[model samples]
Target: MLILKLTNITKEYNSRVILNDINLSCKNCEMIAIKGKSGVGKSTLLNIMAGLERATSGEYYYNEILMNDKSINSLSKFRQANVGYISQHSPMIPELTVLENICVPVWFEKDEEKKKEYMQQIESLSMLFEINNLLDKKINALSGGEIQRAGIIRSILKKPQLIIADEPTAALDDETALMILTHFNFLKSEGAIIIVVTHNDIVSKHCDKTYQLSKEGLLLIS
Candidate 1:
């Protein structure tokens, strides 16, 4: 099964140690939560997991491949092929329609088969997030919760093996947040690994496992 393992992962900036000797592991079809107080480097750790940043020391393995020493280009390719990220605000281009922003990543697929798959995913995910009707609206016209739902569809459009979400339901109300969590469980059942970094108890309580991040490292608190 798809496996992600981090061993002795460490990060430093200038002279500050953000993550120190952290270790974590996750397998397919699992939804995990990472919780921590502000300034505890939760986002930094997510960056490393999403390949947006590299750990200064230690190894990161996906399945059986070692990613610690891969070139920047290779890492970029890896992210494109295997990682999906849902950010706090669900970054979108203000000028683009929700549909356009969601399709930006796979708008020009060379493979007809792949294109069809993405199209189907968009349709299905839009329904799941209940955002199909908002597709025609410009990003600037949508509310925070609506934008967050659209962002979720965009992030998973490619069906990446690893899904990295940072406070995905922060802007959503309780109902919408539960809807998001339900879909996360659905994704897990479909064999995708979901890593969520959130401080929301409702969100954390829904995950299969929970870990707390600190300067000391990552620890399983539940």
Candidate 2:
């Protein structure tokens, strides 16, 4: 099934075009890597899909529903419930404990039983990410890699249908980057649509397919 579709999408800043007539679609269980040089609008594309940024032209569809300005509230709810985003820098609260941070999104669910179920899932994900030890630790006390793993755990804890990552491995060393990418691969196998915006060649090589962004537009690189 098509999980996301972007048709003739364009983004401009002060009349300067960043993305031009880009079209793409992602299927369920697909792992797509978006690669390009610095400042090539890779992150812009991901942000637009995630509803963090608005497209200047064209349309974005998630699960066959058109996403537009009037659907802002619906988009926000969909993102919080069905999409998980991991940016270059992990957005962890300095004062919150790792477990607390992971469970923060759970409060959005009003169902008491479902909220408790999600908390249990979070604990399992923390263990899977090897972050169980850090659950009680404040975010500020974690090392770079620890925080990054926590971020991944937090994203997956919600069992999102789509996972969008922007240079998620940029702060990690070679081995750690490979490990994180491997985890993403595993998630893809379990039926999540994973889209990663990365400049890393290793990540591109491991992805199911790759797209490159340039001044002209988005092109298939692999």
Candidate 3:
């Protein structure tokens, strides 16, 4: 049931090593948090796993399929189908309406029935995240917290098997942060593997497991 595995992964930038010999694995429905100070390779590692960046060494496997240079296209397709990512800054399209933003992923589905199904799921997620009333509003009109919540809802609309969130709660107040984490917990109950990279202790403590990244590399902290 292991959904992700990283073995001896290393990343470098302009000859500077960022991550070194990192190995990690997580099972289906597991929740893990990655924590570190600003300069550590937390986001780098997440990007590697999500196929947004390549590791200079080692290998990755998603659902037991080897992921590497040879599998780039396949990996990208797989990620689009099964992985959802949320970054610290919500990436909603400025011109898209809230409902349109949520439905963006559904446009990739080839099946008419599946596309319609996902549209309905997006509607339900909008209500659950308390953005149903904002569905008609343009993304530029939303407050910071509202946009963040919309990002979360849009990411999960496809029910991706794995969710990677980078500093998702960093911009929110304590109450709002907790509410967002609670929504992640609810997603966990439905058997999604949630991996969050954050510097906040509050967010780290809420995860089922925690890892710390540093110049030395990744360490299991909880």
Candidate 4:
């Protein structure tokens, strides 16, 4: 079953076109990678998927519903509930401690029992990523890799249906990148659709499918 489908997707800035006539379909338990040079529209594509930006032309369907026609408010709600985005840089709040930053996803979770359950899950994942020791430290006190790890933990904490990550492992070492990618696989097994934009081979190689993005569109590379 298709969780996401895009056809004839295009994005343009001024007179320059970044993406042209791109088509993609992703399903449950699938992990896809978008790879390209630094200036390519890899991030743009991921942002489109995450509903952070709109395409210039095309159709976008999420769970068989036409999302392109959705109102701004509807899109925002849908994103908050179904999309987990990890951008190239850490989006953590400098004033928030590592644990607090990681808890952002569950901030509005209403049920007390479910809130505790999610907190425990976050703790387990923090330990798995070896970030548990830094939980009480301010975000600014953490290293680049540590901040990136925290960003990752926040993204998956809600276990959203779609995970759209942009260069998620760019700041991590090879061992740590592999550890994070392995966790993505575990999320996939639970029926999440993972899509990441990256230039790193470690990330591309770990995905079930990899595509190279260009001005012409997205071309399958693996």
lDDT of 2 at 68: 56
lDDT winner between candidates 1 and 3: 1
Best by lDDT: 1
> For model 4, how does the per-residue alpha-carbon lDDT over 1-222 read when each residue is reduced to its tens digit?
757999999889996888899999999999999888888888888888888888888998899998887888888898988998988687878998999989987888898998988898898999999999999999989989888988888888878889998888887788889989999999999999999988788788889999888777889979
Clashing pairs in 1: none
- Cα-based TM-score, every candidate: 0.96, 0.94, 0.94, 0.95
Q: Model 2's lDDT to the true fold? A: 0.85
Local distance difference test, each candidate? 0.90, 0.85, 0.85, 0.88
lDDT of 2 at 29: 85
**Sort order, TM-score high to low:** 1, 4, 3, 2
Candidate 2 stretches with Cα past 4 Å from truth are none
Please list the residue runs of candidate 3 whose C-alpha ends up more than 4 Å from where it truly belongs after superposition.
Answer: none
Model 1: lDDT of residue 130:
87
Error at 110, model 3, angstroms:
2.4
Deviating ranges (above 4 Å) for candidate 1: none
Expressed as tens digits, the lDDT of each residue in 114-207 for candidate 1 is: 9889989999899888889889998888889999998888888898889999988888899999998898888789899999999899999988
User: In model 1, where is the ten-residue run with the lowest total lDDT?
Assistant: 103-112
